[model samples]
Target chain A: MDPLILASEECDIAREVVCVPANVLDLFEFNSVPIFIGLGAVIIALVMYFALRKPKLVPGKFQASVESLISLVSDSIARDVIGPEGVKYVPYLLSLFFFIWVGNLMELVPGINFPFTSRMAIPLTLALLTWVIFVVEGIRKQGLHFFLDLIWPPGVPVALKPLVGLIEFVSTLIVRPFSLTVRLFANLVAGHVMLALLLGSAGFFLLGVLGGDISVLRGSIGAAWFVVGVAIFMFEVLVGFLQAYIFTLLSAVYIESSLHPQH
Target chain B: MIADVLILAEEATESSGIDLLIPTVPELVGGVLAFAVVFFVMWKFAWPQMQQLLDNRQKAIAGQIQEAEAIKAEAQSLLDDYRQQVAGAKSEANQIVEAARSQADTVKADLIAKAQTEAQGIVGKAREDASSEKARAMTEARQEVANLSIDLAEKVVGNSLDRAAQKSLVDNYLASLEGA
Candidate 1:
């Protein structure tokens, strides 16, 4: 079960507004996600603006670092994974990478402790965008035959052609975006939950020792949980970056596949 | 607060399973709208500037490389020309030296032949002069001997006979003695 949902249900039982609301409209009424998303976008825009404001032939330290990061996406992800044709998609890929990364890092922020990507809407939106782009690119490059390649793969024996085509259809059209969405969404949610569980449990025990009872074993367990929670929190930072990288890389791979479909 | 939040948790069976996976409409709408803004800002402004900077740098580097190659080729051509000029000058110098040596040899040979010819002409002129001087001296001595003989004969005759007869006798006697 999702820890946020668990927390929401607990909040509901206590008649309090601690976690996100359960009702869909109530979740919409909740404005924290939008505020954080705006903040992430603004931060990204400012960083990009400053990084390239005084574009130089000989780059300074800040410019070099920014350029190196852009190059990593251009060289390693888009061009490397999707070939020369992928140059056009660098903007989209760069945007996706940084946006998703900042969104994921929101979970670790002090006042705002929810990763925007932990919500299903953001990952779903990004994944759907990737799907639309690759599909459009495939159609643009290869024409209507793109769907034909997906539905009726070449080199299959006539007897097995139908089965293979069905599998390919589901795998290509359905699984691509679905997997993209779930992979990013699930990883961030899991990280958020793990942090919440560890820290919540630690605080419960430690608070009990300090406020109510001073038990040695409770204090030790609380200290251990807090230590582990801090460690996991640091690990979540890496997870945030990894998830962003994976999502962008996969998007590039899908674009490649669309550009050059397997016969 | 954390302990209270946790302890409040019970076996809630209300929302479970795939319901959690579903996305709310507002959040989805807001997320899409937010991302659209981000993508717009990035695609519209940032990317083009970055690409321009990169492209300008690339073109500048390429131009510099081409300029460097052109300079290197020009330098090589100049070096080759200088080497050819040096070789031509060396050959010309050798030819001048050879012509000067041959001219010196010819002049020396002509000088030696001229000296030999002059020495031969002087020796021939000296021999001719010596022969002429010896012939003159011989002719003078013979004339003196003949004159003395004639004078001795006149003294012996003592002037008794006529002058014409005496002259004839003396002539006959000298002639007869010469014959015998």
Candidate 2:
């Protein structure tokens, strides 16, 4: 079988199970997700360290732009969602956004066409971290009774208390992290798969056109798919930013709910 | 053929049901460590500076606004002082004009009075002179008439009379004429 066919078949399996490629380096045998994640983190750290090496009251162009990026997360995501006390969490949220964003942007790079976040490992880990943070915060603030309060909300009727509590337990404790992880992982995987399919089809069709065996109709279809592939590539860029924003926003919301459970 | 190929590919890639959704231990540990390092760097270094920059900007804007307000107040006070000074100067000018006018009036009245007194003195002296001249003329005429009458009598009688007797005779004739 062709390597492309084999890889596509692997994609189906990859979606269901984590497939460790035999050809990968020993260091990345377990999962390359952490290596890419670490690379993203290093890149972000270096950019931040250099960009804000000497923070100025009146910042230059690069510094101003970087400041604006930080402020966007701080003001829009953390502060707006989590309120005044969210100021302390701005750094964490900023790190998460930059890390995920840089990780997602790996798909656009020519040599590296794979996004680190396309894998479930990093997203799951991040989601688990968020889950832990919010749960701990809730427990610290509301005490061990936080679990009870979450499960049995104040407004439920006596008859439906058990049913509602069970639903809340599953949704808040189990489904929240699951959904957070799945949403990020699925979106990135879907985009990566779509891009791969489109590009692969374009390449295949272009070969058919160049081989002079295909009809004009098939050749035009190839050109059309190529154009579509280009368009989806651009769309993926927007998706990348949007996913990062949504992930950070949801994290902030969870943290905020933990801090102030009333809303 | 494509379906067969896909199935074979799926079979080739599939292993012992290790779910993709479940994170492996190494991946989890690496992710946690990496994220921790990044978070620490961000929280310790970048965030504080960004916050400080924002704070500095706020303080700078506030300070500028305060300085502007202070300057405006100072300008207002200076303007007020100038206005007051102008008003005072104007009032002082008016007072000076009024005092000059009053002084001029007093000097004018004094000059008029002095001129009137001088005129009165000149008129009285002129009247006195005229009356005295008239009396002298009258006495001189009377004496001349008496001498002419004596000369006429001497010529007519062809003789001269005694001084005392002539004087008495003249006086007696004049008195008799007056009584008549």
Candidate 3:
């Protein structure tokens, strides 16, 4: 069978097991991790709903834990990116943060390992939402001037003005989504591939032609893979949270830039 | 390749479902649909609530921190007040003690001076009395001596006068009486 067929077969297996969103949804072959992602969000919402049935002066352990995480995201992304305005947007950013983080983390769970973010659809959709928020708010606040400000942020030299406008426009509109999709997709794929490769090295080598042994190569592979796997696991964990954060951060910055039209 | 995947998704159904043979990754249509679902669901259900919760939460935490600061300031003020009061009390106590000491010293000195003056007056009056008594005694002694001398003379004359001298003394006495 062709490798594409094999890959398709693997995807089919992934579909059966993973929450692979049907291609009917998009041009990208992303698993409908959002189904799970959204469901997870709803579930988180439900959890928070029940947890916060009555908002208390002294939060319970679970409430405190959830609130702490929300606060952390608020501090890290909302404050850092949006500044004072960021304070208000923390809720949106926090939801984005936790949802993405949980989506990425789900992959670590046994038998449920493929993160939806590996699919371009997940992050792309999220980034697109950010774009919409910024755009809507931008137009609402600055009228048609929001886009103009993107082109020339008022203080630029008249000579360098057109070039800077073009650059800023392309960066904000075109590069924004591309980079968002790429950042999340690439990290997730890389992390998954790394894990798979680490896990399969022994099986692959041992099953090779005329190979009836798990040799020193296999041992080294296992040991090295284990160590690297552990380190990568931690890094990927950070990346999972960080990419979501970056997505939100960039979104906030982009919105601020568009809204303020200043440096 | 992406186009082919789009066709398959379009063809997808509960009965026909996802075909396992196709391998193409859906990029654009999937992007649109996923974007739609995510944005819609989030905006309608999750985002607003989350945003409200977060906003309220942010305000609350900030309020908490601000309240904590206020409590700290109030506590600090109370502490400062108590400290001032203690300091004032100490100074006041010291002032009272100092005033008492100075007042006692003045009183003691006045009493000592008054006592000295009165003692001197008593001594001077006692000396004067002693001198007057001495003068009186001397004068009295002188007069008693004179009287005794006179009395002795009289006795001696009377002794000499006897009977003979009685007529002469009588004459003389008679002369003295006549002359008197």
- Largest TM-score belongs to which candidate? 2
What tens-digit string does per-residue lDDT give for candidate 1 at A1-263?
A: 33344444443222331233233222222356777888888888888889888889989998888888788888999899998988889888999999999999988988666788977888998999999998998999889999988778777788988898889889889998999999999898777766765665566556656775547664666678789889999999999999999999999999998899886
Reference-based lDDT, each prediction? 0.77, 0.77, 0.62
B59-78: candidate 3 lDDT, tens digit per residue:
99999999999999999999
- Per-candidate DockQ values are 0.23, 0.27, 0.06
List TM-score per model, in order. 0.66, 0.73, 0.54
Name model 2 segments beyond 4 Å from true.
A1-39, A58-64, A109-114, A155-166, A196-223, A261-263, B1-34, B139-180
After superposition, candidate 3 runs with Cα above 4 Å error: A1-35, A83-88, A202-220, B1-180
lDDT per residue as tens, model 1, B21-96: 7787777877877777778876887778888999999999999999999999999999999999999999999999
**Which 10 successive residues of model 2 chain A have the least lDDT summed?**
A19-28
Off by over 4 Å in 1: A1-31, B1-19, B60-180
Better of 2 and 3 by lDDT: 2
Q: What is the lDDT of residue A162 in candidate 3?
A: 83
The residue-level lDDT of candidate 2 at A12 comes to: 26
Per prediction, fnat is 0.56, 0.63, 0.10
